[model samples]
Target: MAVLPLRICGDPVLHSPATEVSDFDDDLASLVQDMYETMAAAPGVGLAGPQVGVAKRLFVYDWTDDADVRHRGAAINPTLWIAPVPAGDADPETESEGCLSFPGERFPLRRSPRAILQAVDAAGESFEVRADGWLARIFQHEYDHLDGLLYVDRLTDGHARTAAKVERKRGWGVPGLTWLPGVDHLED
Candidate 1:
């Protein structure tokens, strides 16, 4: 599978809601492979279809939990439901997150610490996963893309404005934002 160039923040494709994956055909399979490869190359734990310029409801993830167990899969036409916050940690913003679409930046955004995910596997078989902690966070982050929302949008008003400012300062808030190969990491 080839590693596709990522569509950065401000790309229209990223802002628009993706269409459902009605045809579980070979092309869809190939797109998923490309997404996985691209995400791996970017060294990101998760990636959505819109991030790679494909506005279809699909995402690939390779996440390792705190236990160090690795989980890898692709979700097509996925649906995710956030679980209620536990006592005392109602604010999830304390745990920051970063996105491949908004490479090199991160901001704390409130998110559910648990989630229920329902989606078809890469081969079109239906499945369900009960997730918590960082795994849950990844699902929510990717799910937002399917609905035309970014993690930055989930940020508090002040943080959102700051993120937008950074986007503009870096010449990112424009049409046709393309990937800049090696500079695509929050740690950078």
Candidate 2:
């Protein structure tokens, strides 16, 4: 598998909702494998199809929780359910998150503590996962990509303003922007 070029923010694919994955074919499997490789190369916990310029509903994640249990898999045509976020401003120390699409930025954003994810694997076999803590947050964050939302899009007012400035300062709020995982060397 190869590391795909990651689409940056303001790319149409990253901002638009992705289509469902109706064909469970070899090409889809290859894409999933590439996504996993790209995520690993980016050193990110998760990566979505849109981030790689593929408008398909899928995401791959590899994260080890506080309990030391490793969670690794691809969610194809996934559906996610989340509990309501706690009532308070986001805590930067605890709720900060980064995205491969945005690259080298982390900001506090409120997310539900619990989530239930249902999806099929690359082979089209269905499965379910009950998640909490960071795993839950990962699911929610990736799922948002399928719906055309980024973590920055969900940020509070102050953070949103900051994100806008960063986007403008970096010259990233336009289409045709992309980065290679290993070559770009962006760290969060």
Candidate 3:
């Protein structure tokens, strides 16, 4: 497995909806493996296919919950269901999240505390997960990537304005920009 180059926010692939995986073949397996490697290299809990320019409906996650239970797997052609997010402003300290595409930046955004993820493995076997807390947040974040939406797109108030300004200042939201995990030094 290799650490794939991650597409930055400006990349069209990151902004476009990903296609569903129809062939559960060796290529898909390799992509999933590489995604995991890239995610680890990015030091992120989750990474999506579009983040790597694959434009496939898949994401790999490796996050250990507070209970010390390790949750690790690839969700290919996944369907996610989230409980209604709580009403009111987000708690900046607890609700903030970052994306591999956005890189190094974290913003406060509201997300459902619980989520149900149903997807197949590389081998085409189906599985389901009922997740809560940070795990739920991870699922939601990655799922958004499949639908061509970034966490920043879901931000509100000052956070939303700040994200737009950052994108403009950095000259992102275009196409063909990417960063190699562990190779480039990025400051938040």
TM-score of 2: 0.97
Let me know the TM-score candidate 1 reaches against the reference structure: 0.90
> Residue pairs in steric clash, candidate 1?
none
Which model, 1 or 3, shows the larger TM-score?
A: 3
TM-score of each: 0.90, 0.97, 0.98
Q: Please report, in order, the local distance difference test score of every candidate based on alpha carbons.
A: 0.84, 0.92, 0.92
What does candidate 1's lDDT look like per residue over 37-152, in tens digits?
88888879899998888899989899887788998899988999887755432243557888888888888776788999899987889989899888998999999998888888
Off by over 4 Å in 2: none
Alpha-carbon deviation at 33 in model 3, angstroms: 0.6
Q: How many clashes show up per model?
A: 0, 0, 0
lDDT of 3 by residue, 2-81 (tens): 99999888788878899999998899999999999999998999999999999899999999977899999999999999
